[model samples]
Target: MIEPASITNVMRALADPTRRAVYERIASSDEITVVELTRGSGVTQGAISQHLKSLKQAGLVAERPEGRNVYYRAEPEGLTPLVDWMSHYGVFWRERFTNLRTLLKEIDP
Candidate 1:
């Protein structure tokens, strides 16, 4: 289970657009270096490094040093609880929308 504080930290980390982009890039790839992420996103290497640090702190990402390069990858299970929470709300909204649609149909008909 994800701790409440960790969840808050992850949400905070994801609230930044740069960090979200960085996270998405890492998620789609096996692993990436700060230089590669910077080159791909047109952000500075220092900026990418900072975002990576935040992501790592949030448990949304993990890093490994291989030789001289530090590579980052998404922690797949890190977002599971968040995703599940959103799914629960998604179902609630879906049912509400369906009821709304039926009400509108009744009113129009």
Candidate 2:
């Protein structure tokens, strides 16, 4: 039931450290523009735009064009696939930990 494609896209889009940083900034901000992202980032505006494109393709960010600037904001729902995948494995780990806890208690008792 996990969406491999969506997870892959999200992972790939975030694999780049710069891109991940860009995503983080967008996530923390109410909204931002490419120029704002590029400033003090040491990356060119074009590069920031490209990163935004990748984020958009992964459904990680949404954009709204206003006047001469396009503002971007993080899309929280974009992480659903990744969250679902992790939750699926989280159950497995939780069960293992519980078993280990019980075993340790029995040995101590």
Candidate 3:
């Protein structure tokens, strides 16, 4: 049972290099303005805005409107779908390892 939309959103939003860099910058800070997001990234403010828009659509980023400025930050909980998908495999592997251990004990004893 895979969440197609969830995975699609994350993958599509992260597929761009500039967007990925901006995401890292946003995640490293508590909150950042669009102006600050591209300070050292060599990208234009408008481009950053576009990237932020895409990220927001993916639920990977959150925005805070303050007067005339809008702040952005990473939304860690937004990654739940992806994490949950991976965790499904974690349980499978754990069970396999446990069975292997039991088999080894039976062979030795």
Predicted model with the maximum lDDT? 2
RMSD of each: 2.5, 1.4, 2.7
Cα lDDT tens digits, model 1, 1-109, are: 4467867887899999989999999999999988889895888888889999998988889999999999999997778667766888899999999999999999996
Q: Please write out the lDDT profile of model 2 over residues 1-109, one tens digit for every residue.
A: 8778999999999899999999999999999999899999999998999999999999999999999999999999998888998998999999999999999999997
Model 3, 1-92: lDDT tens digits are: 76889987888898899999999999999999998997888989899999999999999999999999999989998777778878899999
Candidate 3 clashes between residue pairs 3 or more apart in a chain or in different chains:
none
- Better structure of 2 and 3 per lDDT: 2
Model 1: runs farther than 4 Å from truth? 1-3, 101-109
How should the candidates be ordered by TM-score, best one leading? Answer: 2, 1, 3
TM-score per model over all chains: 0.78, 0.90, 0.78
Query: 1 or 2: which has the higher TM-score?
Result: 2
